[model samples]
Every structure is written in structure tokens, then in C-alpha cells.
Target: MLDPLRNQSVIFDFIEKEEYFAIHAPRQTGKTTLLHELAHRLNKEGNYISVVFS
Candidate 1:
């Protein structure tokens, strides 16, 4: 679920700190959906500009 990404403290820390990072995972694991959702949320929060390059 979305919690899997939203609840990742390290990830939020990295994003909050503006640190460069990457998310690696196998195929069909909801990576894209997660990213889009994250971007939407982040944008809605009016903090960062999140985009998915694919």
C-alpha cells in the first residue's frame, strides 16, 4: 500500500533534506504508481516539485 512508501522514514528524511537518491525495484511492483502518488502529494503539500522520468 501507499504506507509502504509514506512510512519510510529514511525516504522522508532524504526528501526533506533535499538529498539525491534513487528507488530500485523489480518490475510491476507499483514503483511508478508510488512515485506519481508521491509527486502528487508533495506538490499538493507545496514543498517540492516531484516528477517521474520514464
Candidate 2:
């Protein structure tokens, strides 16, 4: 489920650097899914706790 995001180096770099960022896109474009996937991965890494609220 996280495969697409897993392969995005830029996104990984942003996360690895602990930088603040946002994902903006038109409706029905997977913004929420990406955030959920990111939160799941971040939690699995045990380095940070990520959450999504919408």
C-alpha cells in the first residue's frame, strides 16, 4: 500500500530531515491516502509519531 511513497526519494529525504511540509492537490487525488501511508511508515520506523486529521 505504501509502495509508491516508499519509492519517492524526495519525500523520504524530507521526512528523514524532519522538515515541515504539506501535500496539496485537487480533490480525490490520494492526498489523504499518502498521509496515512506516511504516518504508518513513520510509526514503523519508531523515530517519530505521525498523525492525520481531516
Candidate 3:
């Protein structure tokens, strides 16, 4: 949504390194939204099979 602009590279870095992290924010602060976007990116890469349990 809203064509995510910032979190892509950051999330990709973490996912690339297989590092674990969490998106923390009060409700409706784009936590789930970002996670879904990140999950989509990871899935489309065709390199890492991923899931987001938001």
C-alpha cells in the first residue's frame, strides 16, 4: 500500500542475512502493512521461501 518507499532495502538486508527482527509500533502504525510488503518482496525474489505471521 502507498507504494512503500523506505522499508524495502532495510527489510531486504535483514532478510538477506537471515537476521531476526521485529516491527514494533502501536496498532495501525504500519507494522502489519510493512510486514506484508516485506513478505511479498521476499517471496518474489525466488530465492528465499518466506512467510509473515503478523
Candidate 4:
């Protein structure tokens, strides 16, 4: 099973403010999911452009 920690607004807020941030953890630690959520939030903000890709 994949366990993902949710409600990471603090980290996402930092990124939304045009500040650089990083989330490092072991494999299967929800790194991609966190980034996905962050991107979604930023896009929804309507005041910034958020992009995530390989």
C-alpha cells in the first residue's frame, strides 16, 4: 500500500510565494503527489503560473 501524508499547506504556501523549497524523502514517500497538489493549488490561485513536468 502507498501511504501519503496530506495537508502540506505550509510547504505549498512557500512555493506559492515565489520562494524555492524542497521535499526530500525515501522512495514511495509521496514526493510526486505533493508536487502534484502544489501545482494544482498554484494554478487555482489564479495569480501565478505553476508547472510540473519531467
Candidate 5:
């Protein structure tokens, strides 16, 4: 499994800027996993509220 946080530098920038964004990819491409990991990390840091809608 890939480390969902390592290659997502730009996502952090988006979050910092409070920009809205969406993840698009083929099925089974780890989109959900990435979102879950991102939310986990953000919540763990205690600086933001992250929720997964799907």
C-alpha cells in the first residue's frame, strides 16, 4: 500500500488555502483511502475538522 500522505503535498497547500477540491480517478485507485488518510492526519493534528462524505 502506498503512503497516502507522501505524494500529496499540493493537497496540503490546498487545505492551507481553504480551497475546495475534488478527487477524480478510476475505480479502485485509492481515492477513498487517500481521503480517509488525509482526514485522519488532519484530525490527529487537531488543527482542522476533516470529514469523509463518501
Candidate 6:
């Protein structure tokens, strides 16, 4: 499995700034996976409440 947080500085920046954003990508390109990982990380850090809805 790929490290979803790897090379996601921009996304993390947006998150840190408390800004809204979207993730666009082709199907099966790991969009959901990335979201899940991000949510997990955020929750683990005890900073923000994250959830993935599909």
C-alpha cells in the first residue's frame, strides 16, 4: 500500500489553514484510500474530527 500522506504537503497546508477543498481523480486511483488515511491521521493527532462519507 502506498503512504497516502507522503507528498501531501499542499493538502496538509489547506487542512492546517482550515480551508475547504476537494479531491478529484479517476476511479480506482485511491481517492477514498487517501481520504481514509487522512482522516485516520487527523484523528490520531487529536486535532480535528475527520470522517469519510461515501
Give the candidate number with the greatest lDDT.
5
TM-score of each: 0.70, 0.69, 0.71, 0.69, 0.78, 0.78
Model 2 lDDT on a 0 to 1 scale: 0.71
Clashes of 4: 0
In candidate 4, position 9 carries an lDDT of 62
Q: What's the lDDT for all of these models?
A: 0.72, 0.71, 0.70, 0.70, 0.80, 0.78
Score candidate 6 by lDDT: 0.78
The residue-by-residue lDDT of candidate 4 on 1-54, one tens digit each, is: 223334466675675576777677888867898778767876897876878999
Report the alpha-carbon TM-score of model 2 versus the true structure.
0.69
For 1-54, candidate 2 gives per-residue lDDT tens digits of 334555456677887897867666678777677777777888898988877786
User: Higher TM-score: candidate 1 or 5?
Assistant: 5
For model 6, give the 10-residue run with minimal summed lDDT: 1-10
Relative to the unseen true structure, what is the C-alpha lDDT of residue 23 in candidate 3, on a scale of 0 to 100? 62
Better model by lDDT: candidate 1 vs candidate 4:
1
Model 4, residue 24: C-alpha shift (Å) = 0.4
Higher-ranked by lDDT: 1 or 6: 6
Error of 6 at 48 (Å): 0.8
Go through the candidates in order and give the C-alpha RMSD of each one to the true structure: 2.6, 3.3, 2.9, 3.0, 2.3, 2.5
* Stretches of candidate 6 exceeding 4 Å from the true structure: 1-3
How much lDDT does candidate 3 score?
0.70
